[model samples]
Target: MIKQVRVVLFLVMLFTSIVLLSSQTSAAAGAISWTKPVERETKQAIKGGTHKKQEFAFGDGDLYWIHQVTAGQNQQPYVVTIPVKGESATFRYRAVAANKQPYWAQVSLRDVRVLPAASGFLETENKSVWLGKPIVYAALGKGTIDEKLTLAPPVEVKKTAGGYVLQVRLPMRAGLISEMWALESAEPLVIWGKESLEQIWLTLDVTDQAKWLYDGYYYKSPSTYVPYTETSYWRIPENYVLRSFLYTGGSKAALDMGYVMLKASLKQQEQQGYWKSLPRSQWLQNDYGISEGFYDTRFNTGAAGMMLKGCALYQEGEFCDAAKRYTLFFQQHAVSNHYVVEGTRPGWLVADYATVGKKSNTHVSLNHQLAEINYLYSSYLQFGDPTDKDLADIMLGGIVNLGSRWIVSSGDLHYAYFPNGTFGRTDYPYLTYNDLVETQRLYKLLHGMEEPTIGKLMASKLAWMEKNKVAYLTIK
Candidate 1:
């Protein structure tokens, strides 16, 4: 019996030793794959130091903002070359920070379209970036990654209270594509040495026990809804918002914008003397996201959101209270960083969730980011967060740094974004749908600031709105 026991022990020890060695070897040969898919088309933030750029695709709708380069609040430049289909386009993302680039990085596309994760846009011999620029082949390439990008299965999810909850362990293989850039390849391929781990290859994220996203890094959350739906876009809510993968269009904040404003309106009346704003029943005014329960005007529009919140702060008179109360409401609900969606209207354009950026159906590029930042600044003035001023300053500084990057405006601080500011000089003739209001909001926002120049400009703009009988800042 003693001899048999000894032999068994030896065999067990030998097997254990082999298994341990194998496990250690596997561990040593790898790093975590699948980072957060943060490459969206927005204004990107760049750190002061040197870094490489990451390239990826986006669904066509509006742009989204992803990627974070935080160089302790100064100023830096970020240049991205978007390759769509067979054509390549480039844009510069510039920012200025007081302590760190608070917000950074943007992904861009043109006339882009998106479909579900399981399947969407893919051709027999194609894998282009956002601007139709064909990908280059590497010496040891594994062909195309379109199918892998398009056909990758999603981790199943189920809904729960509190928010959609998900715990995922992504595969390392999913993070990489076999190097396929060939010298002979005619496509706009990667010129070796530009491969940057910082600009992660695949835009995905993983969840685990201890540490995870939104822990310490400065980042922005995607919006309440999406026009370009992707497994990636949906992933944020699935894992963070709740424990379920299905939204069913039944979200916690499912009130049509108007109704939500009513809650804000009560706050507005209690603070600001102005109890009502003009009727703005143009497009989807009376409709709430849910049933036939129509939401009143004092709640939904960006103006109302800010006005109500403003009132809660500056408990002074009409302008003071109305502006403060509404400003706060708008700040809380400013769109998410994710903009690309897959469907059509009825499913309108949206914006980012937490951080300030382009809100869908509102506008695109500088137009939205600038307006939201201005609104946030107004809230800062009415409320008490000095930090908001810092953020707003960074945004404005970034635009100033970009100088002629955007198109020239017809009004004070209003500009267009055509190749060299030569697009349209006559008040931009065509004020994109969400233009006037945002610009007016910016005027009111700056007027609240301490700066003389910006304040004066904002005042002049306000004058223009009234002079034009424009329903500019709707809070009145």
Candidate 2:
């Protein structure tokens, strides 16, 4: 009986040892093959750094990395580059700190674009695999991964003790091309050995080979409420539209604009002197995964400013009260960060969740700042409020600090300054015109004098416009 019991115990111990060995070997191998698709585009904050850039692709597609280099508060232009598929790239993501703190090296994905990541426009080959149909395998540290595919392609991620291995096999197919770049981390981790990693990336295979595609996991672009064809142009920057009407549209048009303005004023009054921006169409949020129901500062402040102008012109009590109330919100809520007046929505193009009672970083806008400065100065003049003067000075000082960056050699103002102090494109000539007009208005409000430099620049642009037969009407 004792011998039989010992034999049973020995067999049980052997089986246990075998199972334990197998489990340890599997963990050591670090071979985690996920059969289902990890379908979601998300922004995750990293522990080492704040910003991250991660890119992943399935199958043998033309892979590239899109990197956003953020050096301190100065936001640089996104650097898009084509990286060799299955190669390792180093990222030195900087932990941007004030007081000169130590930065760390980490890998991350900056912006999260959906799976079967698209290739660049210049690349002729189609590299992105079918959406929601990728086989993803995520491994922690080091090991050799061999993925054999039967009907679909193989996506492998091998992070060895010494180095890394990423390989994607593509099935033969036609019309499988991509015209967009995926997430990328610039190699060498450091540009000039000083810039820190704003982001980094690694390849992962998380596709469910069993199911072709799940219904809930797929994402499609949002359909436009207002569609635009090749020749279509949405009349954005409505300030320009209003100015255009003021310039070319006759008395009837002016009266029509006045009615529109009155309607807007009524709406503002209805909402306690605050503009209620429209929520993004349901399809937009549901389909495109974009933020909806955001308010624009430009519209809010601009409407209030226009109402103030109306009050000054017609001596209307309601207009004056609305203007004062709207402008007063800024005094209470606007955050002064060095020279930048943050927390206030500055432009129509600058959208924020403030409409939905949420806060976002104050986006800088040169044109909006100009308008706000003019409004604030006017407010100070009309109401004799020192707060208005202080606010105007802070915004004006920030703009003046931009100097040549915002003002071209011809003195034509650039369209805007991004929140990171980067100069946005100067595509809108009307923006410069508006800036000139606002500068003149602000100067007049401040010192009862026209800004001569701005006047000269406006004249310069106007003459060129006339010579070239620009469609915009003259503003004197």
RMSD for each of the candidates: 28.2, 27.7
TM-score of each predicted structure versus truth: 0.23, 0.40
- How well does candidate 2 score on lDDT at residue 182? 32
**RMSD in Å for candidate 1, one decimal?**
28.2
- Model 1, 1-476: lDDT tens digits are 01121232232222222222233224312222212222312334333422222222312222221222223333422322222332222211222247532222332222223211111112112231111111111111111112124322232222333222211111123222111110111232222123331111111112111011111100111122221212111111001111110111121111111122222234435232223222121222222122112122212233343343324322324434555554444433332322332222111112312112223222223444454555556567556677556555544554444343233343434433232223222222122213333444454555553443333444545555566665332223
Taking the tens digit of each residue's C-alpha lDDT, what string does model 2 give over 91-181? 2222324763423433321211211222111110222111222221111111111122232332233444433333433222221111111
Model 1 bad stretches (over 4 Å): 1-301, 304-306, 309-367, 407-476
Whole-structure CA lDDT of model 1: 0.28
How high is the lDDT of residue 11 in model 1? Answer: 28
Instruction: Report residue 158 deviation for candidate 2 (angstroms).
Output: 83
